[model samples]
Target: MSSRVLLVGIVRTPRQRWTKAEELEELAELTKTAGGEVVERIIQTRSQPDPATMIGKGKAIEIRELCRRYEIQLVVFEDLLSPTQLRNLEDIIGVRVIDRAAVILDIFALHARTAEAKAQVELAQLEYFKTRLTGLGIEMSRLGGGIGTRGPGETKLEVDRRRIDQRITTLRRELERIEQERQVQRKRRSRLFQIALAGYTNVGKSTLFNRLTAGATVVSDRLFATVDASTRVFKIDKKITALLTDTVGFIRNLPLQLVASFRSTLAEIRDADLILHIADISDPKVEGQIEVVNDTLATIGAGDNPQILVFNKCDKVFDDSLFTRLVARYPSAVFISARTGAGLDILQVRIKEFMEKQMVVKSFTIPAERTELAALVYAGGRIIGERILNGKRQIRIRGFAAELMRIRKEVRKRLL
Candidate 1:
């Protein structure tokens, strides 16, 4: 059975970027994704958050009554709560109290499939728990089992701070080893042009990944449906092949622990030759979502990378004037429906254009008897022009710097 959850938001006089309703709505969706039923939502308008109870003592008491009336199993705050705030809210409300970050962490823990993903989620959980343990000390040790207390939290609840620290150290080492393995794999594909898909959670990046690569990625309506980075090689044209990676989606105010734990995954974006920044054209909050994704890209040091702004799910949009306005506003943006494959040709053309910009022209000759070397050239680059000379095949090629470099190394090795 799903846990009955109550969503709570604090509204300050001077509002932040997202309105109260929008923020709470997103929190509600997050709650549902975590297998919780949002029974009710409460908003407290205050000058500022109360240091002790977050929503102030009076509102906390009111929540106690509401929780009893609704049989609320969980109370989730829209914003992150300090250790003291988390403890105090649970004490006053007489139920488990967690915040937005915890919900996101729990969802990551639940969706984690592969060993690396599991390890990363566990590391993030332990890191979040470590923070909760500090300041509150022994009291936080009493946290019980449920959504926020899954994964490492379930097994390590009774353990002291020292044990948690030890586990954190161990996970970090494991992640470091995984990162080294990734480096080796990256080196193998260093010659290929790399494209990474990055965008807000549930913005159709995974769907587009499947469309572009003909690979299956479990698609869902839930936020953060894709946690692990999945990479595949795709041919842009007869001659141009590149590596495409579908990376974890960004969220507004993503948990710091998650950011630190998933550095290996995000590195794909940082190292990519190009980025496909996908956004859901059907979403009313598309602009805000775009801004959040841009901010996240900047934070991870991929801000200046060449990107094609792609507004996905255009099949759901029926307004032509809206498209005209959007085109005027974002002149370089591409509109496509990843589900129905609409405008995909244009999207591919955009990608091909980006690929061409990074390519260089070169001329080389390989012995006619060495069919394998001729194959290598074809595999690594586009044959702009070619001619057969006496006992040799003279080739003119266009490819990325790395691809041409590999071909040169191969030709030199064979000649020697």
Candidate 2:
């Protein structure tokens, strides 16, 4: 049975504008993603969120009446709410109340596939619940299906909040172990130029990732399709190799707790040599989405990384005048449609050009028995030219200066 949900969006300040009616539409989509139907939407404007209720007290009373009249099972707030606000709201509404963070967690729980992704989502969920446990303990102990109250942890919600705390601690330790393993693997792949795909949720990052590397990660029109970091290698040119990583998407008002929980996963983007910031060119909120991605990147300490602005979904933008305006604004941006494979060659050329600009050219000669060294260069860097003369192999390789130095050290170590 689809749960009937009432959505609320309270604009705290004029500075925090909500021009994107699409956000409400997207919220409805998200509700559908979690198997809920948005029966009504309530919007309010205020200088600050009401301490007792997220919306104005009058609005809260009205929403309570609406819930009763429409038989709304749950009320979903578009912004993050404090524990106190959540408790007070639930008390008045007499229905399950949840903030945006909890809604995102529910979607993540539904879509989690691999063990690692499942663990990460569970960890995030537990962290979120830890803060809201007090409010939920009384309500969740009685209610079953509602906006924030759905998940595996539903029935055994909190036998004891301390037990949940202990589970979070254990999960963090387990995630740390996994993170250590990932660090080792990252070190091994450090020789390759790493590029990460980043953008607002549902902006075609995974689609482009699949087109670039032929990797079939879950591609969907929904938000946060690719939760876990997925990495694959692609040849930028005959003489240049690059590894591309697809990471979790960013959203407006992203939960800080979720960010903290996924820090290890986001480290891939932070450590990348280049960031491909994909954007949905057709999205009316493209500029706002760009700001959100930039803000999230800054929060994660990846603000200094070089980025290529990729204006994707060009196929959807039919107005040539709008396209021309976008191009004029971002002259160096690459326009593409990952779904239709349009403008991919231009994107590939741009990436290759960036790689070439950063590359250091080197020439080396190795004994015939040292073909292993040449193979390492081909795998770890880019082999531009190679020749076998007498009993030695002469090779020319081009790659990042740091990678070249690392290769030189490895060759000397192996020979010594």
Candidate 3:
């Protein structure tokens, strides 16, 4: 059975850029995604948050009545709640109280399938609880089971701080071993052009990744559907083969703990040759979401990496005028629908153009008898043209500068 949930938010300023209503709506979606049914939303106008109950005592009383009236099992806050706030709210509202970060962590725990992803989620959960565990002994009796009560909450949450620290150390060691394996895999694909899809959650990054790479990564309409990094070979053309990676989606005010825990997985974005920044063009908050993705990329040290702004779900835009305005606003952006394969050809063209910028034309001369040397050049790069000069094969090829240098080194070694 789904847990009945109520959302609470505070409006700090009289005149705000974004109203509390919008934030509460997103919180409601997050609650739904976490398997909770949002029964009601409460928006309070306050100059500052109440240090004790977050929504003040009066609102807390009203919420207590609402919980009784609606049979609400959970009260979700639109902001991060301190240990004091969480405890007081649960006491006043008579239900399990959680903040936005906790809900997101729960969703991650639900979707995590791979061993490394599970480890990362568990690490983040422990780090989150390490601070909140104090004074929650009474509340633990109430949380029989629900969101914010998964991941480490199931088994390790009731333990002491010492045990939590020991578990964190173990997870770190395991993640380090996994990261070393990823490093080896990355080195093996150093010659291929790498592309990573980065965007806000539910913006269809997995859909686009499958469209481009012919992969079967699970795609869903829920937030944080793709928690783990998925990579596949992208065959752009006969000779142009690139590696494409789909990373976990970014959200507004995503928990810092998650970022710290998933650093190894996010390294795919940091080290990509090109970043395809995808956005749901149909969303009303597309502009803000775009800014969030860019800020996240900068936070992860991938700010300076080359990016192509890709506005996806173009087919969902019903207003042609709005579409035209968007086009004029982002002249260099590629508008595409990954579901229908519309404008994908154009996206591939853009990728090929970017790939060509990293390539250089070079020639290698090999003795006719040394067929192995000529084969080495073909293996390393695309052969544009070849001919015979003075009984030696002259091969002209276009490829990455590093690969060309490697082929050159091999030729020199064979001649020596």
lDDT of 3 at 82: 95
Give the candidate order by descending lDDT: 3, 1, 2
How many clashing pairs does model 3 include?
0
What would the TM-scores of all predictions be? 0.94, 0.91, 0.94
Candidate 1 per-residue lDDT over residues 276-324, each given as its tens digit? 9999999989989999999999988999999999999999999998898
Off by over 4 Å in 2: 12-22, 137-139, 142-145, 151-159, 365-371, 374-396
Off by over 4 Å in 1: 14-18, 134-144, 152-160, 366-371, 387-393
Clashes of each: 0, 0, 0
Q: Residue-wise lDDT of candidate 3 within 29-114, one digit each (tens)?
A: 88889899998988888888889978899999999999999999888888898998887777777778888998998889889989
User: On a 0 to 1 TM-score scale, where does candidate 3 land against the true structure?
Assistant: 0.94
lDDT of 3 at 121: 91
lDDT of 3 at 241: 87
Clashing pairs in 1: none
User: Which digits, one per residue and each the tens of the lDDT, describe model 2 over residues 1-416?
Assistant: 88889998876565545553467777888788888988999777787777777686778889999999999988888878888888888887888888778888877767666666666777777778777765653735743445555544323233356587788888788889989998999999988889999999999999999999987988998877778889999877676788999999998877777788788889999999999999999998898799899999999999999999999999898899888888898898999999999999999999888877887889877786887887777765667898898998888987688888887888888888
The whole-model lDDT of each prediction reads: 0.87, 0.82, 0.88
- TM-score winner between 2 and 3, please give it: 3
The positional error of residue 406 in candidate 2, measured at the CA in angstroms, is 2.7
Alpha carbon lDDT of residue 133, candidate 1?
64
